[model samples]
Target: MRKRLQTKLSATLPPEQLKKIYNSFDIVGDIAIIKTATPNLENAETAANQIMVIHKNVKTVFAQSSPIKGDFRVRQLNLLAGENKTITLYKENGCQFRVDVEKCYFSPRLSHERARIADLVESGEVVVNMFAGVGCFSVIIAKKVSQTKVYSIDVNPTAFEYMQQNVKVNRVYGNVVPLLGDAKEVIQTKLQGIADRVLMPLPEKALEYLPYAIMALKPEGGWIHFYDFQHATREENPVEKTKTQVAQKLACIGTDYRFASSRVVRSTGPNWWQTVLDIQVSGKPSKF
Candidate 1:
């Protein structure tokens, strides 16, 4: 679909500028999010219109004006084509999520990651999703894994509201619990020492909140799925740097843990990798 849009856009855009257009776009529900750089932004709407013409399912096209930032992790968007609305129903892994793209941060890119984490969930295990946006990971796990419980925590009230609705829409009310507030605060106050597996999916703040995740695990030990973004040059290893950084943080707090595995989940940009560390925390649990 993107190629078709790009081909149609080539008539107006220069060949040098053609490479500036991103090849892939996010299709959430009926909305298509296409990002255009400043150089090629003049033709952004044209591309969006072409996308709408090429793809029958896409009803709304939004141009991402800025990077995802702030406490809510939402980006600024401009309607380039079709409807002006941003609220939409997204489906993934048989679970439904109602989200306002402008208010809540939802990524279709994490679909595989969500399913991967769900597949790792053992029956009867208690999982705590520290950054469950719209309860995507939590809901997917609850619907896919029977006898498992997930405590979905999010700081954004709007995201939390949608998360509650998503739980009902997907009918995973018995398995997924939605909590509002900061992950650390929520975990410390109500979810301490109850999780069998802790998911820190928010790469931006996962390391900062690692202690909370560690404290949320049972003293006997459990799993911590840690996510982070790292920059690596030609000589440095991004994943190793992440592990070392995580180890240093644990050491600072006098905590001991073992790394089960580390994987490069995806490449965010040139020489930048999004990594996940599967860590096993043992021995005495730390006090918040």
Candidate 2:
């Protein structure tokens, strides 16, 4: 889809500026979010206009002007063309989500990962998603499994608000509980020892809050869907490297864990890949 946009844009933008549109744009519902760092703002505006021309469904276009920074994980978006609004309705995996593109962190890229985790969930399972941004993972799990319960927690108030709306929008209702606060405090106060599965989808806090993720699990053991960013060379396998790193941490925390699956979710940059590890951790440890 992006390459088609590039070809469509060839007549309007120069080749050098075109390469800056390198990463392509993300079409979330009627919004087209340009995901690359263009050296010149004008080039991005031109590209955004060209994108709208190619994808008629897109109603808004914005260039990601900054990295996904701070606690909320939201990037600065420069409005390039189309509508000025940031809120849009996005659909995926037979579910609908209302997202505020600037205020919340919503990745269309993680759609596959969300579906993968939902497929692994069983009916009546208790799941706690420690970093459920807009309740993507949790809502999908709830929608997929009729009898499952999901506790979707996020520190960002806006994300949490959107999560609540998304739960209702998808009609998960009693299945998904949207909680607003830090994962550690939420797990410490209310969610400990009650989960059949836990998710650590936010890497910024994943390592620091890992113990809390484990604490949310049932005493016997449960699954941990851990996500992180790792750098690897051409010859190095990013998945194995991530497993080794996760293992070293688990060893110190004193948990017996077996990696059920590992994969490179996406390429964040050259040689830098976002990775995920499906680890089954057993036994509880005092170490935080």
lDDT of 2 by residue, 1-288 (tens): 777877877777888778768466788999988888644787788888888888889989998889889899999988899989899999999999999999999889999999999999999999999989898898889988989999999999999999999998888998999999988999999999999999999876677777788899988889999998988999998888878877888878888889998899998888999999999988776574
The lDDT for every candidate, in the order shown, is: 0.87, 0.88
Show pairs that collide, candidate 1. none
* Candidate 2 segments exceeding 4 Å error: 1-3, 286-288
Error of 2 at 191 (Å): 0.9
RMSD of candidate 2 to true structure, Å? 1.5
TM-score, predicted candidate 2 vs. hidden true structure: 0.96
